[model samples]
Target: MCGSDLHYYRAENDGTPAESRCIGGHEPAGVVESLGPGVNGARLSVGQRVMVHHYSGCGTCMNCRSGWTQMCTSAPAKVYGKNAHGAHAQYMAVPAACVLPLPDELSFCAGAAIGCGTGTGWGALERLGEVGGLDLVVFGQGPVGLSTTMLATARGARVIAVDPSASRLEQASKFGAADTVNPDSVDPVEAIRELTAGAGAAAAVETSGATVAATAALDALANWGRLCAVGLGGTIAFDVRTFLSRQVTAMTSWSMSSVQQMACADFVARRNLPVDDLFSHHWSLDEAVPAYEEFDKQSAGKAAFVF
Candidate 1:
């Protein structure tokens, strides 16, 4: 499951109501059972393995046409597992446009990740331009941050992972982080600076949504460094003069577009990267309550409900 799933589970989302009872799982990967009317048979067939895009919107809007259906201008977007039926059940019905071909090399679990968590990492890295050979700091060792760490290492980046949790930091090392820092023990910005030999990081990605971590990520960047903020929630403040003088470019990335999701799956497949390693738990549907209860502690890696 995604960090967003935890937010919704905890009723922490402002966009969702307290009394709302929608199915909760947007990271969906499954076989095609059947097709809705007007869906070309050639476009999707029974038993085809696929991942759903999760967001449905008015078909004609510019955003929808561009494959960012979540940002459709014509109408409110329906996010699977949020405001609409999702993948918690044995069967799920999604619009044909929401379906993308899963790579033959990836398991359905990896396909599920491409639907949200891992795909978000790809989108954030895309915002960072060329990451190869950069000294990059990734704040937060959650699933999204760990995905960024793994993906950046594949791109030849030297990654410095920051997190308060020791277990999560250990996972970062397994994912190829060159160095790990526990912010609870040391000042993250200072640690990042030391790791980079006082130069600070050439780039940073903040995935904790913690104000302290976000500010530290910003402060831990070298001049002209790029920072991609991917975590949701929390407010951050920085001095304009410092930001201007550093020449650092800061940008925020939402989950990802459908095209990016497809590309992410292809990239993972071709690289043979262990995207499946991101999941620490494979839960059956019956174990969902305890699964989520364990996940809510924020100590484990990604968890998935396997059919």
Candidate 2:
């Protein structure tokens, strides 16, 4: 997906050779040069452009049977560029079962952007439960946060976006956020409270890795509010009493199911939801070094590597 933190899967410092020396790319897309035999249950064809959903699970697992291959129980989950060879190559040979036909309207760049981060953001909203006519706040204006904000707004919710970067907040505004907050200056929780007329938001999504953002995300919600945390690193702490009092339903949304992932990409294309707006940077596979360098520094919005 077109996410900054998603490069963590490609980080060399992780002490795993799967990253340092592997052909690294999970948010993969391109034409299907070929498909392995035994690929069943999907309608992909040769030479068709496609977005590769990142999930290589044992077919026997219930998780895989349900299309949540990320939760494969028969074996440790094996995904491109993570535990196996990846898609950042001239040619890839993934099971046809794991590929989705990218709409002709979607760019390969846009297709790849839906790889993980965008789908992760979409997954969070799918878990948010009936957001229509609700007050929605997203903590962070990065790819995942922006996706949540955009999709929630598309679902008829009023979206408030929060981030430390003013520039990102500006992008959020263009992505359909009703308002933006910079927590670096004022407390996001307080700002959300003020914006929501002190009742807090009806729901919130925390995509910032900072622990404070997690707590702030929860703190900014009204009673019985739903929240989904998608950030990779952090520790959230709050009094049990406050949590109990609010009756909050907290969920940590990870990678989405295949159905959810396909629906998200389709939703983007069908709605013409300027998902490309989330991407401020693009590069070719040959320029991957500088691309990751800039994105690793968190310099801009969503980034994707073009073949």
lDDT of 1 by residue, 20-121 (tens): 767789999989998888898988999999999999999898999988999999999999998998888888988899999998899999999989988898
Tens-digit per-residue lDDT, 1-307, candidate 2: 3453346544565665642466677888888776576655267667788888788888777898888888999888877776667776677777767888888888887777777877888888888878999999999888878888888899899999999898889888988999888988998888999998999999988898789889888888899998888887877777888789789888888769888888888988999988777777878778877777777767777777665
**Which one wins on TM-score?**
1
- List the candidates' TM-scores in order: 0.95, 0.93
Q: What TM-score does structure 1 among the candidates reach?
A: 0.95
lDDT for predicted candidate 1 compared with the true structure: 0.90
Scanning candidate 2 in windows of ten residues, the lowest lDDT window is 1-10
Backbone steric clashes in candidate 2, count: 1
**Backbone N/Cα/C clashes per model:** 0, 1
Candidate 1 residue runs with Cα over 4 Å from true position: 12-19
